[model samples]
Target: MGHGTNLLRRGPRTAVAAVAVGALATAGLTLGPATAARAAISCEVTYTGYQWGSGSGGFTASIAVKNTGDPVTGWTLTFTFPGSQRLTQGWSAQWTQTGARVTATSPAWGGPVGAGSSFFLGFNGTWTGSNPPPTDFAINGVPCTVNQVPNPSPSATPVTTPSATPSPPPLRIVISPKSIVVPEGGTAGVQVTLSQRPPGNVIVGTGRVAGDTDLTASAPVTFTPENWDVPQTITVTAAQDGDATDGSATFDSRSSQITGSSAVLWTAVERDDDIVP
Candidate 1:
């Protein structure tokens, strides 16, 4: 009986030690064969496009991104156009195009995507010659499985249909070179343009919305119906400061004349001139 009791006490100690070892392994002690790593990012994407007119035509592309891996707080979708596709407008995301590559980043109101969930983004673009859809896509820098949807076949017999009234494009302020770095005590310029022609002459104002007070913007600029599409330069000047740390500011373009027009924000960073002590 005494020997049995001793064995039972030793059994508890062994079990406790085993549990301790398991805890350490769970904490990444690597006691055994390496644990399989979970992929940080994985996705599946669907792409579809619709075009109207010919030669220089306009297209609208829709993309659905399904998360197959972990949850993501934010996402950036990237692709390369096979043809000469140019982005004109986008929704649900911020879109930019450079050469053949295109990028779409999550907007402020966009929400996160959980594992096994999906989100949608799209844009309006212009193309010439051929309007071939992109074959590849990546989300958050990881390659995604792409599923391309074929364009619908035209009807053999033409049928007359009533045309609905076309809606006007949303008013927007377009700023070129949305970001810049202003040298301390120097100036940098950014061009501002209107997304669409205004009803009449529009006066756009530039002002600092937030951040360092040392950064200043030029006076208001006017955009007329004749030159609404043309870019108007807005000069940003950084005041010299004694601090050695780089300062940053947010500048916004606004207009009181254009109702429902959204303001555009741009960032400016002041280069530090003073050396750290």
Candidate 2:
């Protein structure tokens, strides 16, 4: 699904360049009334903004269409999504998704998007949890007044009990300077490692530490997994001055062996799979 094509050909005005390429090659898809009197000459469409792709599991967006109305012959776009973010595969156009709605259409070589021109279409999804992305959206069916960019919150607060007593498995932690390229106020020294299996004291908590916007640390240090299975290391010393972006460091576990941190600031309520990554 790599359909990202952009073609804009404007050479009209020589007596309406052969009636605008024969009215954009039979522009008929049932818009009757002779395409509404040829769209009353003066089209307009715009929506420029969107492109995302990340993983802890799933996310993909890529929308961006423009026309500013007036030279169109075809086009239609729609958007929607809130909870179960669906919509999986899409490209140059022609797509549909029910539940958390989505729609796109623009083939026939993108009919006629003159008057300024711009195009893009993308889709791919899966996000059954952590909701936040619906400040109201729309396009083609109008609305999309702009808004959709918010995903960060999962520092710590995930551990619920149901009963049956069987919990202990989730500590993949890995830090070894994974990122601390200091300089904005310089000062770095991180070394956190822990796989799984061993238990009996392993606490390291501060919540968030991705770029250390002005780094500063003193939390994290308590290990003992050198025989109960193997995998352990602890070293902390962070200190940045401010602003540069890209910081991370979080840990919490003093027994019960269950840690977390891959890039989820805060938002978890139940998840205990036996740890092993």
Which stretches of model 2 miss by more than 4 angstroms?
Answer: 1-55, 60-73, 78-89, 92-105, 109-122, 125-131, 144-161, 165-277
lDDT of 2 by residue, 159-195 (tens): 4658797776666555554434333334445555565
Question: Per-residue lDDT of 1-277 in model 1, one digit per residue for the tens?
Answer: 9999999999999999999888866766454445423337899999988877556678899999999988888899999999998999988999999999999998888787899999998999998887889987999889999998885423212556889879898767888898999999999999999989998988999889999999999999999999999998999999999898889999988998878756889999998789565
* Whole-model Cα lDDT of every candidate shown, in order: 0.87, 0.50
Scored against the true structure, residue 154 in model 2 reaches a CA lDDT of 39
- Models 1 onward score TM values of 0.43, 0.19
Supply the TM-score for candidate 1: 0.43
Clash pairs, candidate 1, are: none
**Candidate 2, poorest ten consecutive residues by summed lDDT:** 264-273
What shift in Å separates residue 29 of candidate 1 from its native position after superposition? 9.7
